[model samples]
Target: MSLEVPRPIDPSLHPLVTGNYRLATPAIEALYELVTRCLRYRIPGALIYGPPRIGKTRAIEYVRLLLARQHPRMSSYHAQCEHKPRHAEGPFFANLLEAVGDHAPHAGTSAAKRSRLLLRIREAAARSGSGTVLLFCDESQRYNENEYEWLRDVHDALDRQQIKLFTFLVGQQELLAQKTALQVAGKTQIVARLMVEELAFYGIRNAEDVATCLNGYDQTAYPEGSHWSFTRFYIPQAFDAGYRLVADSGTLWQAFEAAHHKASLPGSLEIPMIRIVKDVSDKSPF
Candidate 1:
């Protein structure tokens, strides 16, 4: 059956979004890098995993918009876990088909129908020399082990249909936690709730990744403790200034150098990107 979708609102305008993000240039470039790699050769998939409310979904959406604007032929599907859990075999597939088939003459009548349409869509996508098909699932923590297994089955069935297909899953630490928790306690209700294990040692890969990610992050108007690209010292601001410094741009280290006649460190002003995204997006700063 054609799943009934609720009325749509622009997620970009949501409060959690709205000029409330660091540049995340490295992550954005990482996605763009994936796109380039996929078209040239073929990369299976990538997951933009991070902590909850860390702008994973927004950053991904921005990348998707970039793809749509630059490469209209490349197709994409975005499914929110809160909605449309239709179909037994492939719930994720059903959402994928919805975005892929949007604006088409015929939508799917059932999950199987959507699956069939998606195969044809991929074929058409390749022949036309258009955009690639990217299946993005946000809030993936809501997905159960059974749902993930179903997605794996869908990929196996359809992998041969096209030369390249990519599935990007974005979820919080809770997603990983649920699996670990399940392993600890066989059957638990916590799986339905968004939860995941922590990634304690996450940092820049090489010097290149750091440079790119830092600059790409929107530093202007960035807050302390969250938007790292905006801060300079990266230390507890209140300890030094008696209040958190909120300078979105310019180098405070340079000022210190001018005063003390000494060179300051490179990462002296990295406002916590995660913290800024959360706090700024909550209020109507725009």
Candidate 2:
């Protein structure tokens, strides 16, 4: 990820993105691979995670497209986490029921929906073909205990169905550690069969509140004061309302980076300027 406005990286550019161009953006590609494997009965499942707007949703959308094109016989659905607190139980069952093709009309009672839900779940599994189902849950960090437990149960129910549903969970960095804790608490059996992939923050450094996209690390977050200098040096100033903002005007942010720890250098106050956003690419998240 980069902050420099000139070097923008647009995530919606295409249907297929090879990591060879992204340099350090391998996390999404790796998560995409794991989901592909899960569809083919290779892995039990995998999760996709990162800071918000860091490309988690983009990865899932790409994978879903690939799977639909190549497989053509699987079911796919996406569920967003609740913004407010909720018992995971109802939503979990309802989602699973929908996934299996139950599509139950809204009901006031879970018990009333149970029979048809199980029927659909069983029927989807009994398709007697190379059929699979995938559920991609975004913003999963909001999942409370109820949601977490419901997730565990869903894993179990899917296993019993033999539907080979691949679940890709997308969430914050805490989701990783939280999953481990939940599994250890004996709330889940899918833990043994599940694997957590790592997506290190190769981007998002050398900045505060995110000036550029996920370019490099911020100058602050650690000792490299050169980061403050680097961002100031590389990122051009913003011009607005007849006011020309220069790199020197970045003094406060530079100091912020320095406090995080980077010592920048002084540059010419009257350096030649260039307008070059189009010339730059694959740097900042636009």
Candidate 3:
């Protein structure tokens, strides 16, 4: 008789692997809906703002995945904004080039970089079969008016080519403040171009929300085709005995609510996605 060796578990299947895994929560569903509308209407720009650690970035990723699946012919790219003490046109275009996977991003002048950006984006849109592209900018709160002006130039250049560029800004609440500041400064051109639509991201708001998120762990499979879910992977015996994470949602919500009261925290009890995921991931049947 031949002895068989068991396959090693994939580390990515673990809940703590963070970016490697994502659960489709209600907030993500809302964000996806907004993005879908923006693309459907060919909206120039939209803003997604939320408090820090509220899963905005993750939501962006999830939405991107959904968009790719639903609109297979669309092109999408994600770029993270850097806080420069002083914004320059060269660095601005260079950042976009890098985000779009340009080679020799630093080998050109600002004008040349801008040209490259336009060409790359145009080519991408052309190849997408839909003639449209989505640009998601994270940490967009760091962008200044000048940076926006340069971005607007890119948008205009692409528009001239008949390629639709839908820019979505994902950042903290300061993004809203920046939009207000721009409006007050009479920079309506930029506002009209990019900030015409806005959506607020939120954390788990109630026991029902908690249950929905927990249900993802209880039902989502690991290794793409395996029967083992996150909950099952962590507690196989209990899982086989019919235990599920969704059953604990009410208890988790009650504990957090009580803790908020004990600490005298203000406002309604809203738990960040990171905190909720960490709380659940840290627990074990043992």
Candidate 4:
């Protein structure tokens, strides 16, 4: 017996496959508003804290795109913090350099790397019409006290150049604990500069929230000019038959509630986007 060759699938058409898509959600929109307010006031930075797997990182990614579209000329950079047994200045600056698109991140001493990073940021700010630059530090709960101080140094240096630097520190709830720790330790300087503002990112809280996300899949097209949204691309026949992911919102929400009760999980039923995405992509009834 002979089997027909399996058809090729485009990764871009499948978010589950490529993991390169962001949905428009109320939480993300709220986060964008908070960031814009900070930029408007030249606030040093804000802390975006939330529970794990609730899409804070995804919100950051989406908000960065929004920043580019809305500001047009402002420069933005993203650096991911890592869990360090001990803080090392060299690698920390290297991470910043790499995030800012430096060609030789490892080619200099700690001070030299910092100098280059500042130069690049200054150049970026100069190129911008607004003289502003934004930095997003993900996984920032791993950052130690010294890291925050070094960040303050960068903020001060940029201020001297008459350029505004706004940082968005995105991490899990430990970030709040860190902030309180700083405040308790009389590190008012760090708290005032970096943690003045805070935002709590949340997940789907109700059926309406589920519908909003489902609507995104219904409207978002894949492959840059195709009419096929992620939902349609995966189930063309059902899509043509007037089937939409949004129509499944009630069922999806009910499933989440049932599972929460089954597991005896505490707290209100807040469903993480990661879990919803997994369920829709992997086990949707359609």
lDDT by residue for model 3 (1-286), tens: 1113232375444545644777877888888888889877878899999998888888888888888889999999898899898899988888899888899877789999999999888788777767788899999999999999998888888888888888999999999999999999999999988998999989999999999999999888776578878777777667789999899999989999999999999998888787887787666432
Per-candidate clashes come to: 34, 16, 0, 0
Global lDDT for candidate 2?
A: 0.49
- Residues 12-55 of candidate 2 have per-residue lDDT tens digits of 43111222122122444466667765656655556555656555
Tell me the whole-model lDDT of each prediction, alpha carbons only: 0.50, 0.49, 0.85, 0.84
Position 2, candidate 1: lDDT: 17
Model 1 misplaced regions, further than 4 Å:
1-24, 34-41, 69-72, 83-93, 102-111, 114-120, 123-127, 175-286
Q: Report per-prediction Cα RMSD to one decimal.
A: 14.0, 12.8, 3.6, 3.8
All candidates' TM-scores? 0.50, 0.54, 0.89, 0.87
Query: On TM-score, who's better, 2 or 3?
Result: 3
Q: What stretches of model 2 exceed 4 Å from their correct place? A: 1-26, 95-105, 112-128, 188-190, 193-286
Better of 2 and 4 by TM-score: 4
- Model 3: runs farther than 4 Å from truth? 1-19, 284-286
Cα shift from native, residue 207, model 2 (Å): 18
